[model samples]
Target: MAVDDSSTDPDGGSESESSASGPSRSPSDSVSAVARSVADPILEIRDTTVAFNMDRGESRVLDDVTLDIERKEIIGIVGESGSGKSMFASALLDAVVEPGVLTGDITYHPTPDESIDLLNLSKRELRDLRWEEISMVFQGAMSSWNPTMTIRGHFEETLDAHDADYVAGMERAHELLSDLYLDPERVLSSYPHELSGGMKQRALIALSMVLEPRVLVMDEPTAALDLLMQRSILKLLKEVQSKYEITMVFITHDLPLVAELADRLAVMYAFQFAEVGPTETILRDAAHPYTRSLLNATPNLDADVDEMKPIPGSSPDPVNAPVGCSYHPRCPLATEQCVEQDPPFFDAGPNHQTACFHWEEAAEEIPFSLPEQTDREASR
Candidate 1:
């Protein structure tokens, strides 16, 4: 609700009508149009996998990881911690490290004919893209800010990287803070510790905009803040997305934020996407066992005391994956087939996809089953 109203930019009018020039498609159809417009693709990931080959053994951190980000859309990636939530974010920037062998396709298209495999890019290449084409606002965003650096300088560094105009950068940064309900002058002068948790998070967001990256990956950007701050940040993000016309990939376990802010969502489990779809459709009618568990796990503020639902069992261990459907061990509707065969993503509904053997049959049963509180704790 906040996102829709807050975005004021020409492109940010929530779900602005798709142009007739592009086949008269609606905003909902933007994903396909975006993919088509690019000569190759803006951000493409297909059947990508990442493995961690530690001394003990080779552990697949991500299996068949894939997703695409288009221009001017916000896609939310949701999952519990250790579900490889943050790892997926790092992998997008080709930041996964030694002992971590990446075998995935992460390509970014700056021009219709220019595409670079982000996974294989050198440090200099990545440096060029940083803050310009694909920037990140990391988790613990507040602490990431230098306690010694003034907020203005931190914001300036991003602009300075690309030799953007210094005076214009400060002016735009001030406007951003004001749009987010932050005091421009105060925030500009404040250090990390001097600002409130929410302010710091928003400042980090403002910093990411200096170079106007085509896509911005935000991992739990407001995890440590309060509900008010969370909503404020979500609103600010919507506004920023509109004003800057940047495609966003929002990572979090916060269903409320997904419901409130994201147009589309990608569900992650054990380092891969279990499901992804339009936000409302995914939340109200999840088709993945992990996703259902996450929804059922979300504590409903409107529910009666006795009606709260949570998932059962712990998340599967990524290091030692279970045989067959990784979620079978914890899935309520898992069958023998589920145990022997891993589920690949299939069409669950219009614009919805899932990787579960019994999604169709089990969808009806999951909503009624109350679960153990810790099963899929969406812990930030």
Candidate 2:
């Protein structure tokens, strides 16, 4: 499917103005670019849950989560730490650790007639699917790389594992790094320890895209970079997504940071999605109390420093989660109903859903403030 390349950068720059040249089609493009007569959504996640058995008991890290990721769109998953954001990404790739049991359907649509349930796939099948079809840029790029190996060796190893042409893969890696505004030759020759933090992060992204996967899941890709470097990385990610027409699931705890890049936002609280909607709609009119609290807690540059309110209480223990809504303990608009029953997703607006019983009263209960003008402008 063809995607529009007219997306503007979050920094008020035009995507077409980048100096980097566009990449040519990979050698395996013919095999990966199968016809899609299926629906618009590329991934269908239904009633998915991940639980780990420990000495205490079974702790549910991910609740019954259901989400549809559209093709060629950037969807941001935001939440506080331990909200199961990273676990969700891990589950997508079937990378859950031992003693953790994953349930429910995670269907991947690669072609018109093919529908593969990720949970049901064999180990070998899952291995074949990863990297070639869905690639991940894990958190902490420095630790992810080998200190002994040069950047070129990393690319060669990845290509070798996939049985791809080593020479062609290296050439593509050079182009990818160049597109990221990096010195390709120097980066390729240098070791991970030799490059700066920002450089390593960008190089990691370049490596993830080397195989040209259909979906790219990034977990805190800019966690270690400075503000300026973060901005640059976000811009480069946008450019890469637009150029390759690949769908991205960007996971982060910083709502403001994701606000600058995501097309749609999914706010997670207590191992479940509190709200999911278009970026502009969620920013302007959040329905769930947890979502509202998150917005209130976020420090807006345009807003007063005193106005930044933190969410009361911490996330619940996964092993001893509340009976009803896990967020009810922290939610301001939470009532007896909220404490007694788990609320299903209610329609907040067109294509906007929130899992809050007091969806109507959440806004009135707590003041909802918009983000900075620049963020809103960028999202629009």
Candidate whose lDDT is highest: 2
TM-score per candidate, in order? 0.83, 0.88
TM-score of 2: 0.88
Candidate 2 pairs with clashing backbones: none
Residue-level lDDT tens digits of model 1 in 1-380:
00000000011012222344421212222233223322234677665666765555566666656566665778887877666777777777877666566665778877657788887777887887876788998877778788788988887777777788999888888887887788989989988898878878887787787666788998888889988888767867888788877888888888766667787777776666677667766766787777877776777665565665566677665556677877777788888988887665555555555666677766777774332332123321
Model 2, 1-380: lDDT tens digits are 00000010111101111123421112111111111111367887777788877667777788777777778989999988888888889888988776677787788988636788888888888887889899998877567798889998999999998889888888889889999999999999999989999999999999998987899999899998899999888988989899999999999999989888998888887778877777887888887788888888888878898998998898777787787777888877777887888776655655566666677777789886774475537545
Q: Which stretches of candidate 1 lie over 4 Å from their true place?
A: 1-41, 111-113, 368-380
What C-alpha lDDT does candidate 1 achieve relative to the native structure?
A: 0.68
Residue 31: error of model 1 in Å?
14
Question: How many residue pairs of model 1 clash at the backbone?
Answer: 0
What is the lDDT for 41 in model 1?
42
